[model samples]
Target: MGAPSTELQELIELLNSENPRIIQPACEYFSGLSGTVDGLNFIIAQEDIFKQLMKFCSFENSDIALLALKTITNCAQNENGTYFYMACDKQHFCTKSLFKSFENGDERIIKSSILLIENITRIEAGARHVHAFIEDSKLLESLLKIFVSNKPQYQDLSLIFGNICQVPGVRKLFLKNEGEIFNKMLPFLSHQNASCRLGAANCVKNCCFETDYHQWMLKDDSILAAILLPLAGAEELTDEENDSLPIDVQYLPSDKERESVSDIIVALVQALHKLCSTQMGRDALRKYNVYVILRELDKATIERDGNENMTFEIHNVIQILIGDDAAECDDLNKLEVPPEIEKKLTEMENA
Candidate 1:
């Protein structure tokens, strides 16, 4: 950290210029600069740089604000810088400035704002700060509005919910939404886009952390069935059903397509592991014969030498559902193996 370079100083001054022309380029320059560690440290070293950048977030011109938000998002890449952004003005970056930018009807600004907030909440300190503002403002509702509108920002909104919902209170608010967030995300388990399914699975995984929420999830057999769909590879997302598959995925030959399916399996297995923590939750899984699905998936994954982490999770969930006794059976996949035979098999193996 030598003394600030003349170029850095000039850019900082140019960012503060009154002319929109100068400001826009300044935003772009800073955006590029924020990409590197040295450049990031330069911006972080500048006094009140974030405070100055906050002014650009609401310049009445969407492009400038978008660039400004981009720079802010880039700064968010560093944990220390994120704390600095969150602390710029007692959380004004989130509360007044960024929230205003979020509502300005600019998709770029909205997306950038979502990413900035997501970065902020990456740590608990920043998460707690944003959570307080979320309780008071229409932040969560605004995110839901964007989501239900089926806008481009919906994926980012899904991720924002995943981060915010890690807070227990916000998660309950999510469950109470009119559409019932659980129901909204459940069908995505069968979505054609693999990332869509992964995002939905991660959010659902966080929701299951709350013990009280378990009943809402477990009470509906249909919910469990729909969730299992992705894991079973039961339904493929056809072009007729969903036209939104990324062009790269849609154009690739069929043989290359199952790559997406493997990612979804990892998310589903991770979610089920979280969902099956309690005895009642385990009972619900058993009622739906989810263990059968898990065993089949486990066998397939082991045979394929698939994702080791996901395969391990599938094994763990099956054990939870069928109990420690299942571990003793000759073939754990046989859900109906008798206790006597299981004991004899274990005795003979141990012998």
Candidate 2:
């Protein structure tokens, strides 16, 4: 009825890293065969498959075996009269085996363990199940310790933190005290490594999901302002007439350095116009000369043929705060545009 149990026995033989290339091919070939009871039974029956898989887990070589394990667990972890992962009601074999792996395993097992537990927890048949054997308080404490630990830098930490960020409940567990984990992660926002900053941003993004983080990012003129400071030295080094100097030779600091801190200023204003559109956002935006910025940005989003999507959202914010445009200037494009304030004047024309 099935491709003789030899295929299953062969896959189990391929589970160890000593076998090397066999693991992935074994997974691919066995993936199609996992649902068969004869195959799964043979896989579990094979000598040393479980122990080698558990040991190989920490090595990058273990990813395929872990995936295969997760796949087999999912196929076997059903409910309903159907012969699937439903072993929960009929028996606890499938879910219990997964929890045992999580209980008596290293971090290599966490990847599949967390996934299998979440799947079991969310199962229609296992609705009443207490799937997460690791308590939130303990897990958050453990994860935070890793964030500040002096241990080796493993990419696995990034993947784990990234995964935690997606689950709302897990995130609350990580950030419940506000000052607890946040103070630790704050410095990494500008760490020398780009991945650390990106990971920190991702963590911030998750934490500030319900709050207005962009507002917070802009609250201190320092953050965005910082990006422009270096860009100034960039302009002088540009070779217009000749290859005058390297891009931004570090000249002695001067009063002109202040001007260097400045940009078209219109560039960021333009980005913000596309961003802040609601009443609260507009009010928070008004903290800076946000209206003038939006006016400048609206001028920029315009096309050769006409204006862009900003007319509606930008104008909506303008209308809510300042009232309708005066009867004479309601439709802005009709106004004569001056070349000097050509961009600013287009605001009226585009409106």
Candidate 3:
């Protein structure tokens, strides 16, 4: 009855079938689509579709139901977050209906709550209202399960945890009372999934302002080599290996690293470039061999950023290090890229 797509309708119809083949692909397709909540809310408003999804969330067939659950959540939480929050707060509407998704023996419903709550938090000043849920402490247990859940739960949980960790009081609770929380999520930094690692990294970065997160990260075995290695040295990069960093460390034309995620990489380059241009981060970079990573990253930007703002920023970094004329050894003493490396960089500029 709502504005409809054949794909959405097709997935909805296929949900009625008991065939595993139909349900599996249907779940995949459902997960892949980001439909308007109007369409999903309209469909759920119907008695039949609501009942079917509820059944799937039950112990009967959670695998299929989890797919529709996230889809519905995505719609409700999309740009119309305020609308959904207002509606959910109403007793008989989406809020009541959503809470019903959580039930005994229903892992899918429980898991889907991560996305739904995340959307709720996006409302203007809406996080304050959602924090009321955390006040109950019941959500904390569910949150931990979702945070640590494997497979499909990983990204969703990381997102929800990321948001939860942002609330000022909530973060303190985890750090002060639940000391093990951040450490539990450390392994996620090296997750095979880039988005997962990126999300987890941002989460860890937040913890840096509290306690000993940066020092802790420096020592953690899982994160140290994978992340710190490139930042610590100018080693060769394979196509796959280079794809890993937020920056393209390979620095070559036609290299193939692609993502629509992790804006933090750009943020890191910009931040480090600024930090390095200063007497402090520059001194730290030189003393710690961090300049090699910056130099290679700068070379990559020569073509990728092409004298763009990012290039100008790196220029500041280079200027500070070599004193605009390779006349300083004070800062370079800490950085060990060798004179030959500097000569090669100068040659590239002239060429």
Candidate 4:
């Protein structure tokens, strides 16, 4: 990057001005710049501008603070821009400002802060930082309070929870306290917002990797029902099969629809598969007649979108659900993979 242009220097000075008139337009100018690739590149190259933007997030004027946060949010949309925020000293100040925004009594500021954190936590380094921040600030409890209270329009916080839980250390936090925190997140699987549904599904799927939680999770009938309900359609089931399913998914109206998003469907299916890793989980699923739901899902998915991958996943879950009990492993996660199969998986991943 070359030296900051004379015009760019003047803009930076104006951004530091005490007058709201000068500050607002300067923040808006960079906010607009941050929206385009060339502008983002220019902004990212200039440390002074980047620092000023971070500083503006804490500005006394809500409008200027919003513009600054918007600018940072736009910049953090990609990997390079996200890494720039991670590398800067102002990143801590930016993060503190984000949490402080929650108390500023401005819905727009709070949402912008949440959006910025969501963007940042998409990367591993940022996830680690935010995870620590949540732990230290006891932010997770506060977030759950908001969520359980049915607070309107804070669905994006679920995305932040999902992103951070990808880290092993952070995931354990949810699993703590007998998974009370994790359980609170279950209802959102059927939330009206597609983003909320997707985020909740992702969190469930990621946490399911802890096979130890299978028994605890299966104890809550709602968890399995939540995972399966999205896969259930308007198709009528046999009376016996309908009675056997978890209550939430047992009866379907003629116009009942499956989840529209492919990723959410896939996550729910994968979570089901993980739940089946234990014999207890397998028994619970079998008792619920889950295979009947998957059977319909397989056909529906194939007909609706020809999503072969999702179909394959459905088949995998069905295999375990209906497999002979005598031949079942006590814990599927403990089963060793054959060398050839392991090599094939590695090759596929690398390819």
> How displaced is residue 189 in candidate 2, in Å?
2.4
Of models 1 and 3, which has the larger TM-score? 1
Candidate 3, residues 301-331: lDDT per residue as tens digits? 5576334554554565556655542335333
The local lDDT score (0 to 100) that residue 115 gets in candidate 1 is 78
- Which is superior by TM-score, 1 or 2? 1
Stretches of candidate 3 exceeding 4 Å from the true structure: 1-72, 90-111, 122-128, 136-142, 149-151, 177-179, 209-261, 264-291, 301-351
List clashing residue pairs in candidate 3. Answer: 286-334, 286-335, 287-334
Instruction: Give the root-mean-square deviation of each candidate in angstroms.
Output: 9.6, 13.8, 11.9, 3.1
Query: What is each predicted model's overall lDDT from 0 to 1?
Result: 0.66, 0.43, 0.51, 0.83
TM-score of 4: 0.86
The TM-score values for the models, in the order shown, are 0.75, 0.40, 0.49, 0.86
Candidate 1 runs further than 4 Å off: 1-9, 136-139, 177-179, 192-195, 234-264, 302-306, 325-351
**lDDT of model number 3:** 0.51
Clashes of each: 0, 8, 3, 0
CA shift of 349, model 2, Å: 28
* Candidate 1, 1-351: lDDT as tens digits: 444478667877887788888888888877787888887887776655667776787677778887777777788778988777767758464446676665666777777777787777767677677888778536666666666566565566565666666777777776774336567766665555544566666667767776666777776666565566555533244563223322222223433323236655776676676667666676667665677567656766676653666666677788777774333342223357589997975665344
Residues 82-187, candidate 4: write the lDDT tens digits.
8888777434777877877777777888889889988998887888877766675377788777756665557788888888887877667788888878887888
